[model samples]
Target: MLIIPAENAINWKRPPWVTLGLMMACVMVFLFYQGADDRKLDAAIEQYLDGNLLALEAPAYEDYLQREIRFEGDQQSVLELQEFQALREQDEQGWQAVTLLFDRDYYQYLQDNRDLIWSVAERNQWSEQRGAIEEQWISRMSAFQLGLVPSDLSLYTLITYQFLHGGWGHIIGNLLFLFLLGFTVERALGPGKFLVAYLVCGALSGLVFTGFSMGSQIPLVGASGSISGLMGMYVAIYGLQKIRFFYFLGVYFNYFRAPAIAMLPVWLGKEIYDYWFAGATGIAYMAHAGGLLAGAALVWLLGKSWLQVKEEFFEPEPEQQDEQFTRGYAQAMASVGRMEFDLARRQFEALRENYPDRTVLLEHLYQLAKLRPDLPEYRDLARTLMADAMNRRQPEQMLDVWNEYLSKGEAHHPLAVEDHNRVLFTSLKNHDLKAAEKAFERMRLKAEPDMVQEACRLLLAEFEKLQMEPKARHYRQLLRG
Candidate 1:
């Protein structure tokens, strides 16, 4: 029968590179999904302009218009007008009965109406000039575009509209929340799952906002709906952990701990309070509430997996079995500090018997032996400890013991390196010549002139030693070159 140790049971920690790649993949997916829809809308608009008015009603017209105007702004005026003109021309072509059904006056009204045309034109111009400024401002608040009636199940407005925002403060605030919470949640969920959570939260929030607002024309923007999901995950995972918060009043700073679960209620309560009493100025409380609910549901579903991971990787190891030996060793150190050598020696010897495999303790035993070298047992013990320390890779400690032995004029063995070098220099000094040779080889491989020149001195030294007249003379000429 075979039994595996508890420590080897599971791996809960993900590699940092894996986490980073997941983040990049999430960013790419978001970009591609958003881009694909935009391209589809653009193509539809183009086809409508190319005498296909029947195609106009087939697509989500308002959504495509909103996304185009929001993203392209004034820069897209010419394209927008072209599409509009094509739709008009296609209406005259009778491609669809609805196009012909509209009276000449109504059709002319759409064509001659400068207000709608200018509205689109101005939107296009404004978007082109201030796309960056607008994006920056809109990233802070909870926002969503109008969803379809009845089912309210749609993707275009729900996805792209979340990327739009109301103003600078809203965008900054939302991005700040995302930056703070996103990294932690992403690390926990992996990139793919985190992104799925984000999109779901945004879609849910949009659905709720559309239901409540109905005819409201306010453009929605920001990443707050998704950030609320991260907040929910934080609460679920670290419910028992106390969160430290700081507040400043004039020159004084106050600090306190709010139980992790309590922050959710506090946050929700504030949003409710602001929505009812403080006017519709700061936050989108309804969308936030919707996002919070979605997040809670997601956490409940995934909490068990997260908990298992946490338990496996993060628990502390139990204390060592030889507690008494460790305590005696510590006490011996304390006795040594007080210069009670005899007491220290007695405590150390007792520790040595219990922890015979611990080489660190052996070094301490060697030092104690040196202080009492008059005893033959002390000398024997020191040599045994010194040899054990060297074998265990405690080189510095071994060197210290070796120096003490040398000073006392006792029989001591030198390390291998002491034969070639006068005294044992650091590993670097011994390897310098070898390193230089490798560097010279690399330079010759690359055909570098400076490398060839540097190798001349090394070559001359080797030649002088071997008394190779021809090779020495050749290196001499190369050095001059």
Candidate 2:
């Protein structure tokens, strides 16, 4: 029932509020406004089935099916009608097989041949019965006005229908799609633009469905139209870029990497195929296809100005990058062996530009920067190496590099509050109490109060072990704070 991108996990640093908010809105609308709709519709239908209206309409409903068998000239329709007739004959209480709705055409059929069908009094009674049923249909079902009826759609109902749903399965499936596609698109376009685009696509999907099903009384209700647009926008934003996709093909569900743009056509084809072959399955397949088109077109029109694609979401795994650069890395190391530091530095710098998180590369650059602190790039490499306390492969070397740079009277960039706390632990790992003491003082500025307290406790214990009374006493005073 769904295909979604599984490229990026949730980043707590940037929560997708707009996506969550939209999901909440859909759920709340269903609970508060649409919840009673099902019960009300059932009440009206129950009344129709229990009353004389069923006796009158049952034969007429059968006549409508017979006409389909005679005129439609299709094996599918004929087979379906034959099944219906067979089901009725097989069951004793079989008249219930004829399900009735607010079918104006069938009502008109009854009225036009009133003499053949019934007497004047009987016709009047039939009219009164259907009239009473119609009244119950319109008034009792609370969500009837909110749904987008194709024959009599209003501007207000066009958008409102998207928020309304038929039942639990419909709303749950739709919200899952909204969260999956909406977050990335929202992160790209931002909240305001994402909301605008979502509404526009939903409206367009309604219009597209109306174009096909105009003059039909059935109301279209669900967020699928809007969500389909998000699917389109997702592909458009990452066009031609290879990204991991999780797909389901009826019996199969699996993931593979492909250009994100390629999925748009595949998704469109599925919806169009279902529309052609599924045959009155109640899903608005055309609306889904239209929404996908509208979403892609909106992003394409806005171009880069509107869509800020985050490359990290679609980039290859680090192992793939490592494999790609292994030969280049060997060449750089060969240059280092030949004492061609300038050429080696150039090659490492090039590699760092693409994969900055490569720890071995950074360690090599730090070593190179030590050999040539006179160069302008040493300051950048030194700052980069020291700031990332997360690169825990070589903490002793990093502290030594930091010390040499500062001892030479070079200006130091301050560590971020969180990084400063991490570096405190890093300094202690190397048994550099003097450096840990400096890190402790730097962290005193604005690090988490809890982390600072923990650091004081740790320093007190470590210094006491070294029989350094003055350092231990200083930490004791800070811990008291």
Candidate 3:
């Protein structure tokens, strides 16, 4: 079956370095070290086969003795033996020569006197082939020394074995699970604690396998135990939040969303059943179960503070509301384009309460504000837009908002003093002395000393052009101040 997790809600301010580092380490070890070992094993096997061929071609009395005993166990062997006897009757000297050399169990004789046999074999040039075969078997067995064997438990193997995978399929499967679930749990417990949890859980898994698989000598490897621990930690941290999972059962494939905590029993139970009741498939299912239990218990013991951290990461799926907003926004724009103002305004008003942060809704509201400044939503949108304009340094947009809303007392106050200078200069350029006077007064209230002096000089020039000496003298005094 296939199961995959969708994106989680946790937004890290930076990349999850610990998870990325672990992934890089695994890839490096597999590519450089474990891959070289595989090539060595293949070469050793080929050498063993070559040596065995040489041994087969070199006929010894030992071969006849072994074949004679093997012949008693099978009908084909018995027929071959009968043919040999017929050859003996036809050639007495040849038969006597064979019998003299193969009268006893030469295998036992070789075991009792290997030195004596090797001396005779060396004279016949067969000793070098035997030595090559033995060397090949020793070289082929060396890779297993890196893995953790229950019968020969060591602290180094417990940790090292998890990083050594048996094959590409094994490494790929374990790393896939690690990437899917490791980042989420890391975000939940933080990077430092996540590292601790991973190593400790892996160690616990190795211990469980050692205890149950007692006398077995087969070595265990791979990161399944650690990855399964992260899976358990994910359940504990997410609590009741529903997470979407992709699944496949042979011919059938489907997806389902369920609470993270809900899958714990099903996952742990499956591991337990497979470990105890199912036929052996060379998988250490009990170790996976132990890791899960250890991880879950560790998180639970971290108390309410960690539980609250989990709650902080809970973000419900936004798919439904986001779709609704999309459709509503399109329909509202359509109504406006059709010149149906009332319907558009109503649609925009409803959208305002629920999705005020949406850019399109705010824009539509700004349009309505331009036509009907009396509406409260229009004024609210004006303030939002004015602030946004100020942030973006869009002076013309701010001037538009000030004239359409703030100057008309539609919006209460100037968002910034630098904005008023633009308005005053604009009004003076338009020859609207009355509007210029109003903006100058507003500017004096909040303008900086240097800015106020600059505005006073402009007013002095405009007033002097109208031939108003008293007002020009008043501006001269203001500039001097």
lDDT to native, each model? 0.53, 0.78, 0.69
Off by over 4 Å in 3: 1-20, 36-145, 183-194, 303-384, 406-437, 442-474, 477-481
Please, what are the lDDT tens digits per residue for candidate 2 over residues 284-323? 9999999999999998987666555555655544566678
Q: How displaced is residue 162 in candidate 3, in Å? A: 1.2
Candidate 1 colliding pairs, count:
12
Minimum summed lDDT over a 10-residue window in model 3 is located at 99-108
- Per-model TM-score on C-alpha atoms: 0.40, 0.69, 0.61
Model 1 lowest lDDT segment of ten: 1-10
Residue 109, candidate 2: alpha-carbon lDDT: 61
Candidate 3 clashes between residue pairs 3 or more apart in a chain or in different chains: none
For model 1, residues 1-481, the per-residue Cα lDDT tens digits are 1110111111245433433443444345445433344444333334333433433322323334455567766434345445555765665433332322222223333334425544675545433432332233222222322322223345776765555544446556666566556655655566667767777777787777667766443555556666676676666556666765555567776666766666676666765676566543536676776676677667777667642224422333224435666677789999999999889888887877767787767767777777755656555665575567556666455445545655552433322222112112221233343433433443454445664565667666766776978867977887886
Candidates 2 and 3 compared: the better one by TM-score is 2
Which structure among the candidates has the greatest lDDT? Answer: 2
- Number of clashes recorded per candidate: 12, 0, 0
